[model samples]
Target chain A: MKGLKIIVLAKQVPDTRNVGKDAMKADGTVNRAALPAIFNPEDLNALEQALRIKDNYPGTTVTLLTMGPGRAAEIVREGMYRGADKGYLLTDRAFAGSDTLATSYAISCAIKKINFDLIIAGRQAIDGDTAQVGPQVAEKLGLPQVTYAEHVDKIVKNKITIQRRLERGIETVTAPLPCLITVNATAPECRPRNAKHLMKFKHAKTVTELQSAVEDYYKLHEDRPYLRIPELSVLDVEADTNWLGLAGSPTKVKAIENVVFAAKDAKQLTADQKDLDWLMGELVANHTLG
Target chain B: MNNIFVFCEIDEGKIADVSQELLTKGRSLANELKCNLEAIVIGSKLEGIESEIAPYGADTIFVADDKRLEFYLTLPFTTIIVDLFKKQQPQIALFGATSVGRDLGPRVSSALKSGLTADCTSLVIGNHEDKKEGKVYENLLYQIRPAFGGNIIATIINPDCRPQMATVREGVMKKEIINKNHKSKVVAIDVNKVVTDVDFAVEIIERHMEPRKIDIKKSQVIVSGGYGVGSRENFKLLYELAHVLGGEVGASRAAVDAGYVDHARQVGQTGVTVRPKLYIACGISGQVQHTAGMEESAMIISINTDPTAPITKIADYNITGDVSEVVPRLIEAYRKHSK
Candidate 1:
């Protein structure tokens, strides 16, 4: 029997957890460059899940995909160094400043160009924590989504069994294959980078990807392979131009505000009978209790 | 008139209480906008669910009932919600940031190609002068959420989208009073997706349902263990206290990681955020990331060996004593009081 085909969705994010002079701004948008860019921690956990399944199932091919600026090719290449059979980087100038909807539209377009038996993503991105893009991509792809997944327990021939962690407890559910899952950190920690695999993909850059390498080589040795990321036009991924990036995205930001959290000096609602009566009345009056 | 669309979360045929809380908030938002509020429930066997929503202030109930939706897999649920937005455009949409909701809200809004703000802590009506008169909203939708690790609040607006959406954390608001037989219209939207069109090949096997564990997020009373609880096994004191209070067991993320309980019960940035009525923090030194989740409790009491524990700063009452001793006493007090 052939192994499962798993594809992981990963994002390159500013390591916001790295607190330094460069992490925050005077106005509060993240100082993207102050912190080094790293693969999202949860997305790494997502990648690890795919790798573990491959290790257990054997014959599995794991593919990783991302859509971002050219720098994201490094994250995909890093995934390739982690046992991913192939990595697709959808790097283009047009995909910048995308909100969740626009980002999902672009990634979904990219996924359509590949065949996969399973799709996985982190539950939420660390920077935004909106937790929207994964499910949004699943919706655009018209796939079943099992979110807040903490562990993958068993796999029958065509049915997949897994544990979904909820606020209260865990629910074991069985569903058919070809679904999307957004995993949480409670899943297994990501495996460390492998050495041999890293060496194999170190030279695995596209022609465009190697262009920068040549420039850097010109600067240093001027002899080594010049590397530049492969920049895919919307046509390269077979994506409909009408439905990619901002043009295909429908949601638009109306405004953005910075809110300050100030603790209020609140009086306690007493447990006395008189206080209880007043509280009950207040609850009912406020439509909290009837 | 402007109408608010409330996404009422139903898990295993039961309506999640957080969605009811959202209805209460939505009702007020709808009133502030001077429009009707519709409670949207998607699931199978949803006949009596609408009866329980009206007291919370729903004027109309939208149901997308189907067997495929019996379990929440994003596809079927997101499709129905998008269909509703297309058919009956509402000015504002609100959802609970539960596992299902946090996943579903964005997908539906995006599918309809609209905007959504996630993990919102509050919402208000903005001036609708931007829209021409006779439009759905009196002004605009003001979506608010805690951003930057819950340190900063952000109010985001989607001026172009029909229904500006937000997903709020649980217990941030009080649940609306539901009148059993309030009169409301139930509209069934026929939203369907094919089984074969999905690209992700995932399978579901037997669900190894975790035996019923305490759900601290929904509990009105929580007996929580903190760092001073000493060891993971010492969490039994929290369970004893919770049993006496007829409440649920909870913990600081520290306690959960100290091997005191399963990670599912961890409460903090990466764990569940809860707002119970009475939160008893025993032996905890409250950090911002941890307190950000539980700060909204109705009444908070801090018990720590150290009088200067950070939790004491915000606690309504403080008991400075060893949690190993104080928790047992609190349990005894609850047991005697209840009996």
Candidate 2:
């Protein structure tokens, strides 16, 4: 009924959707440069839900809060182009190699510095696939969280109704405002970038980006405050140095192996009935089926 | 003593297969560590749960059966699990990467300040060698999972954390019944001790389970479509083929995200991993994201217009033709053959 402050937690992940020969390095670490970085797929779904809320309730603002390297600022701009009112990029050298726990810590710290009535995020990031950061962030903020959210059905008074997609069925639950909801991939796809919004926010740059730009865009940023996308470092959020990055991250990578499926066990067959019958018979014989 | 723990999930009064799979894996891990394997079963009226998991290799079963826990509510479940973990202090904990586990695992791990790796495809005990980080942890749980959409398999380790936690996807590990006569020691905990009024924050207004839901993961045969399926309307052909075979229909992440099918039917790294007896892939190019989920199937039949499609390489039978035509013929042939 009243105005709302919505924050969509997003991430810029290496397009894990598309993998090439150089996708992984010899050491098994992802070759970030080989794959183009794009906004996390589900986060875009979360953004759509947030955008819908903004549409229903005018004066509501949707801000994207993404925590990654300096390159992650791109997702913030991407979010703005798709109608996010503003964005914040949480990046710093100390925040490198953060697992879900540490990542949530940083995001929660930044959230504390912002005004928000609803916190929305993707069920999980494609790169990590942990799906923990959203819930972990909610826990850190001491807020109720609804995971596997398919839709925000309605908001009556301070209570919000959500439809959750589960393996067996759908459940409709209600949580009070100031809660967290992680949108599933089943949610609506984000609206395409508005041409007007794209043109308006295309020039928006973070302080780190503005300083390194080839063009003299500092003067333009001064003239238009909205053109400036705030870059918040660890210190900006006043996060504890000890709980910022690898030090706070309890999970460590032991090794990475590039797995290629071998065709050694496969037997090619024809599409004819005889081959199909033989295959079916063989499966039954082997106890794979009956 | 350090022990291995499993969170046995119950759905519709039956122990989930994934939990049994974890118990099978946990039994061996506990043996290697020279410790006991215990399971936590939380539900109401769980009279036979102990006997149910007895053959799965757990030596102990902790049950928290209360009316409030009859259906899973996040806060209460997390509270009890956290309390039990703190009291028991198991060395490692495993959960099924399902809706209940995904919702509860993170909350418990975060509350306990422990690290949890989710949806692991493989679990092993090995030394963690991080040469770049100049650190090596001996005898750690090697939580192996496909990262970056199944592009690479990363072995995650919680070297310094207690109760190193991980959630494994269903069908990734085979559940072996060790002893049918085995009896697990049952220990019931009082729910009132750990639960509080504040834990009931989110209220469940309604729960609806769609009748005859297509559970592709458990289907004996799965007919999956991909980008080659063309459009949402064309997916009906997959349904027809699957129907004739008495199987369920599945879709690649591309197809699901394209609105061809529901996310529940998605089979990929981002979706469900299915080890069906027979997997018929139509129009799917067989990206690792798609293949990794169905790689363990007994047999793979890929139908694609492109002969050189990567899926063809791993497919036992690669039918190089248009799926729209091939599927119809196959459906008709199967119908006639059955009749």
Candidate 3:
């Protein structure tokens, strides 16, 4: 009968699904500039789940929390355009090159600074595909986690029921409030941006963006406090330096190389009748096909 | 004792295939490091589970049988595993990249302050020299996986962490038994000590696990398509070809994302790893993620308009043409030849 305070962990990631010719460099490193950055698909699913809860609970509030470069603030604003009440962008150079564990550590510290009942995040980000952060964060915060969640069935008596989409079938589980859930893409698609919310939050900007603005908007921000999206630094979250970045990350990248398959000296053929017939004959002779 | 530990997962009354696969891998890695291979199974009514794991050459098997753990709740499983691992001090810990493993591995790793790599394609014993630290570490587990959307292969190492943890997808590793009569030292864990009342904060209300309806992994012959297949209607051609050839139809991740086919039929790193006898890849530019699943097929035939498509390099036969044009011809040719 009461509203819930929820935090949706979102990310801005490169659209890896449609990698282009310019996606990779000559030496096999990622050409990030060439790739388009978009809100992570699964995170959008998680946001939708959070928004649905807010929709059902009349007084509920949804907040978006994202950790990335200043550009990731765009997702926070995007979340607002989709019914989120507010958002915080956690950005700091000290938080760079964090593996899942260190990333979760920093995120957990930030979550502690905020007041929330439930935390929702995508199962995994496309860029890393680790699916480790949600559970890791839950562990760091001493909370239970339900992963691969397809639907949040209901909330009653401070308990949340979720339908999880496992490899084989479906499972329904219940966890108390102040827990975490990681949503899967199999859930419903996120609702489209609202025209009214979009018009209202279009000018929302992080501190960094405000500093780099071509025009002076200090007076405007002072007048409209809601337009000032909070940007949290490592110190703002009270995270230790040793556990914030690459230093805190236990996993080290030993090596990275372009994917190169061993050439098998394939016999080249065309679509001509002769080539097709010959290929079929060879396959039939070898019992490769009926 | 520093040993290699595998968190063997159980479904119903049997050990999961991925768990057995990891046990097989953990055994070999233990052999290479000259350490003991250990396995931990946490569930209810798991009395004779050790019999299944002993053949994998595990020197020790830890069983924590309790009703609370029969269904995997993240907290309880993590509590049991983290406690055991803290005492055992395993050098390497492995888990399947299944739903349960992915949920439990990171929690345990976080609790123990360890590193965890997910969906690793290969695990090898190697050495790493930290130039910055000026330290050379030997016999590290090389957690090799496809990174950045399968564009590159990254080998990760946890130089300063204990129980270097990693999760591997099912069907990625080969499962073999060392000896049928091998015996293992069984250790029973006190569930009440490791798992407390707080661990049961989550409750399972209902569960329905269905048998896999479309299992492409067991298909002997596969006709797979990709984004280049163009449209959902075009996928019908692949289905027809597969039907005529008495094979199954598979789709790449791109095709599945495009709504051309169901995700169940996807063949790629995020999907199923299949080793069919004959694989016909139609209009699929071979991304490593897609190839990782089907590269080991007995024979591969790639049909793409692009001559330099990466899939061609690994294909035994490269047919340069459109799928629409090439597939029908192959189907006709096969029909005529077979008759």
Candidate 4:
């Protein structure tokens, strides 16, 4: 079997599992600086699936692609430590404030410049929770897509079988190659970073970071191509300016409110049958259930 | 020319409840926008399905019935929907945020270059004032959903995009009844005009509907187990209690991660969000991830050894004891009282 060329779309999102009072600003925008940024939880799961394919097929290569600010390049380095071969950072001032549509447009533009057999991404980003970009990219690229993927069962002669985790059950289906898949968190947890790969790719930096670095690493990057993270701006990717950033985004935030749930005068119940019977009776009377 | 369109999902030759809920909401939204409320049904042999939608106030029902469109292959279904959207320009489109809808809605929205808000808890027809750009868009759908892991609610609006779209959460909105005598105009389109053989890129090998399908989100009552349940054997008690209560079994992420249960039963940020009428948390230490899914229940009851478990804080009724002991007694009481 020919080695598969896989591309994993990863994102650096705010750790939403932990939110504080300052997590949201007065204007309802995320207080990104206050919250620590980490690789999107499910994106790690996507990387694991890609890495597994590379492990099973000896010569397969895994590439990481992420679109965010300059700091988002950290995820690229992180992916490298976890067995990705190379990474691309799509960063530009014009890409700010883009919603799912424009975001996918920009990402698709970058993807068009690359060659790959399969594209994989997390089912949804924790920050937006839209689960649109992966499929949207597939549509733009005119490729078939499978979402809610839990496992890749097998690949033979350009057909890939996937087991999807749905809300109610599992569905195992097969799609032809050159397809896109958005993985679910139910997939296997990503393997930890390799010590040797970490030491090798630790100094990998995007052009924006290398420009501001005080230490001279240009010679080192020239010697080792893997230490250089490719950076693409809107111009480099040939994206339309009108479809780049806030202008390209159609969704607008109307308002935001902080909701705090507090129950008043909750009834206390013992573990005995008397209280259970009363509780069940109250539920029946209120038509909560029969 | 602009109308409100709701994608009426079909399950086992019947319209799904979530579709009716969207129709109910779509009716009011159409009234607000002074346009017609239409429904799109794509399936095989979808006769008599129009009645289920018309009563909910759909002005027109468009059906694209074909044998190939029966089980929802992504390519064919997406092609049909996208072709319809292009021909019929809608001001706003609504979809039930179920498995089929979630998979198809994005593909359609992207093909049309439209914006879609997913898993919206509430939706309203309103105006959007862009404070940053000093622009105002009148008659837009305000899509509201929980953000930051249910910590806050954000209202999203697609101002610049046409055919503003949203997928509503299941069981979030109330389905209402209108005049039963009213009938919607039924239009049947030829599927061959749009869908071609090339759409069938994905082949189905084996499709299996779960034998004991546990639908926690739609269940009226849910009995959820947590890590404190200890072992796989202990989860049997939860299933027994849930059986007596006529409720489905759910599990927290901890129990699922610990290999005590399958992912389908998980209730948390990463799992299914449920709003059952009665939610009984058994031996579950309520992490924010778990509570985010079930806290919306009408009544929350927690039974745990640790009284200070986070779930107890929000629970309407708190019981301090071992679940193994309390659950059996509760089951016995329910069995006796009902008999």
Root-mean-square deviation (CA) per prediction: 9.1, 9.5, 9.4, 8.5
Could you say which candidate leads in DockQ?
3
Q: How close to the true structure is residue A212 of candidate 2, measured as C-alpha lDDT?
A: 91
Off by over 4 Å in 4: A25-27, A262-290, B131-134, B211-339
Residue range A189-277, candidate 3, lDDT tens digits: 99999999999888899878999999887888898899989999988999998987778999988877654433357999998978999
Chain A TM-score per candidate?
0.77, 0.88, 0.87, 0.88
Score residue B153 of candidate 1 by CA lDDT.
48
- Score residue A211 of candidate 2 by CA lDDT: 84
Accuracy of chain B in candidate 1 (TM-score)? 0.62
Best of the two (2, 3) by TM-score = 3
DockQ-based class of model 2: acceptable
True contacts kept of 3: 0.90
Q: Give the winner by DockQ: 2 or 4.
A: 4
DockQ result, candidate 1? 0.23
Clashes of each: 33, 0, 0, 0
Better candidate number, 1 or 4, judged by TM-score: 4
For residues B27-72, could you state the per-residue lDDT of candidate 4 as single tens digits?
9878878899999999998888888999999999999999877877
Which is the leading candidate under TM-score?
A: 3
User: Which 10 residues in a row give candidate 3 chain B its minimum summed lDDT?
Assistant: B146-155
lDDT score of residue A163 within candidate 1: 86
Docking class of 3: acceptable
Residue B16 in model 4: lDDT: 87
- Model 1 lDDT tens row, B1-339: 347988988865678877888888887777777789998887777877877787787899988787656666665566567766777788788888887788778777777778888876557677543344454434676676655544344556676666788888765665657565578887776645423334224333334444446466776567778777888778888887665454678888888878888777777787788886567888879998788888887667777777777888888766666777667665544433321
Query: Which lDDT tens digits does candidate 3 get at residues B294-334?
Result: 99987899999999999988899999998999999998898
